[model samples]
Target: MQSPQYLRNGEAPQQQQQRLPPHFHSTVSVQKLRRFNTLILVFRFASFCFCLSSSIFMFTNSRGSHFPNWKDFQAFRYVLAANAIVTLYSFAQMGISVWEILTGSTVLPETLQVWFDFGHDQIFAYMLLSANAAGTTIAWTLNGQDTCTASNAFCIQSYLSIAFGFAGFLFLGFCCLLSGFRVVCFIIYGFRFLVL
Candidate 1:
């Protein structure tokens, strides 16, 4: 028989098993956390690839009449520059992530890293979004009534490049979310610590 001492807490063994403490943890297992971090690393790398490809696509196009390359339009230049910056940032972050996964060391304090990543991500996300909007808007405005015109290869290429830029923007959004989650977790833990 179960000891009477177990019931002194005022619950049966089965009942206690079913009821979690009010402050119970909801964290993922360590293995799962590693996998999640690796997954984010892969995703950020893919984002870097997309940004690089988009930059190449836009920069190489010379078919447009008015504008020979991405530099011709301030919006296109912005897109190219923003994507390049994001590409570099993603690469660096990927390295940090890999290092963290392997050795459990971070360049910054855990909370600071989370906040730093979140802030930089928000900034870059905004920049990428704005650049994408500007580039796509200008591309469409240049296209006018023509529906992806066959004659204007530059116009078509511009659209395609902008599409790639949009893809990069999507990946950046994912990075932002991951970093934002880290920041949120840090904030929650800070609050809990204060409470305790």
Candidate 2:
């Protein structure tokens, strides 16, 4: 029952509609999302391990009669404290990731997570870097002093701890990159992750 007026345009409307792909606008792929989330989790866990080790190594090292303990050097104390802070933050962030995976949902708003990641990652990275630099400077100065065998051993341990702190900083850089990518995705695609 085609109307003569509609028939003037050529073929039927149903044929035109069938030519378009159905469900073409859905941008988020569940599997891809899970993979991205998992990558964050893995990176954070590695960062946590490095930070924790850095703190332990620095805190446990004794300066012998040189200064008695780690508290003797402000720089060493800063390194221990900064690493401890970053360790806790990393663990909390990992917990958030795990919760999201288990619930199959975002607890925080999508945009918030992106910015939160960027801010915290930047903050901790800088803190760790600064602490490492300070500690390394102190250790180098100590090594140059021609101290006793005990003090030299303590300086070596301090270097080892700073090394781990540097490793954590590198991992945090990766995390920042991922966060930036997420932000770009949001800007370009309006929203990539599925809600709920």
Candidate 3:
């Protein structure tokens, strides 16, 4: 019978192939991904609600009397347009979020979807923020003038619309951060960074 040969001096035995840890491809845990998906959905829905309400309030600010309406102010029109656009975007995102939640994958190709989410979220968030700022400035100026005194309802509606716009922007900003994180992880770890 022959015995197994031993390693010679200064010679090392071959090592077996080792399996990587579960988290080798992904830094975020499965639980974290689930939470993130849920958060994205919630934020998208919140944005939709706020932006929709903002648009409606701004659009309906007109009274039957001869008081100057939201359309009269360029800033107010911008606010309405921005919120309307954001509302549509948020509604679409909400559908995408629901799709991801039901299926652990994105509707579009993973890379394209991640980039799309990040880009759109950033653009719309900033758009809503700027619109709110301009609307707020106009509202403040109107408040200090006799216009607000004559039609306090218009001033109140304008402020309310702008408030909702800011709230929508805040939620959209959160979505942007989440999407940006996905983008960074993808850049570093590829699509394996998350199950999607």
Candidate 4:
């Protein structure tokens, strides 16, 4: 219970203490938000590219010969369809992310945008994962068959397509984690103190 140091100096505590400029916290928070938005943009772009490649590779896998084409299998068709849908979704998300980065605000309300991203990321990621798994199973089974020996290109391309699908899923998984964190923060802070 000793007397305070400021009282001994006859100086007010507010005058003696150092205070940062009012903009300091806000500036740092803005920079953090821009960086986060940019990161999300990158992830969205990556997912788009992977999904696009997966779709393309599967689409062009037909050799027009006796070889089993991608259309011959239901799993391969699912892979193509899932990748195509995710590619479109990723492209749209990238646009939104870019808008936020450039404007420091979202086209949609912050709460809606955050929840929308989280829900879509989860759904698309799981769809891509399941499609890839199915495609890989088909590819693996075909690889073990004697017929695969005659069509090396078909097998290789199918594997490549599945690989790209998995890569897309990986990026979407990252986006999901980020958006999940955003959703939780929004829920707790109600967007007032949530920087991302």
* lDDT for each candidate structure: 0.75, 0.80, 0.87, 0.89
lDDT of 1 by residue, 1-196 (tens): 8674466478777777788665343444445556667877987888888888888887887755644555667998888888889889888989888987786446777767777778888898788889989998888877764433544777777777778778877887888887777666668764111122
Native-to-model Cα distance after best TM-score fit, residue 179 in candidate 3, in Å: 0.5
Give one digit per residue, the lDDT tens place, for model 3 in 90-111.
9999999888877767899988
TM-scores for every predicted model: 0.75, 0.80, 0.84, 0.85
Q: List the residue pairs that clash in candidate 1.
A: none
Q: Model 2 segments beyond 4 Å from truth?
A: 1-28, 63-68, 192-196
Task: For residues 1-196, write the lDDT of model 4, one tens digit per residue.
Answer: 9775674367666765665543244788888878877888999999999999999999999888677789889999999999999999999999998898888877888878888889999999999999999999999999988758988999999999999999999999999988998888778866623642
Show where candidate 1 strays beyond 4 Å.
1-28, 63-67, 145-151, 190-196
Which TM-score value belongs to model 1? 0.75
Question: Where does candidate 4 stray beyond 4 Å?
Answer: 1-25, 192-196
TM-score ranking of the models:
4, 3, 2, 1
**Model 2 poorest ten-residue lDDT run:** 19-28
lDDT of 1 at 168: 79
- Candidate number with the higher lDDT (3 or 4): 4
Please, what are the lDDT tens digits per residue for candidate 2 over residues 74-134?
Answer: 9999999999999999999999888776665666887787778778898889999999999
Cα error of candidate 1 at position 108, Å: 1.5
When 1 and 4 are scored with lDDT, the better candidate is 4
C-alpha RMSD in Å of predicted model 2 compared with the true structure: 5.4
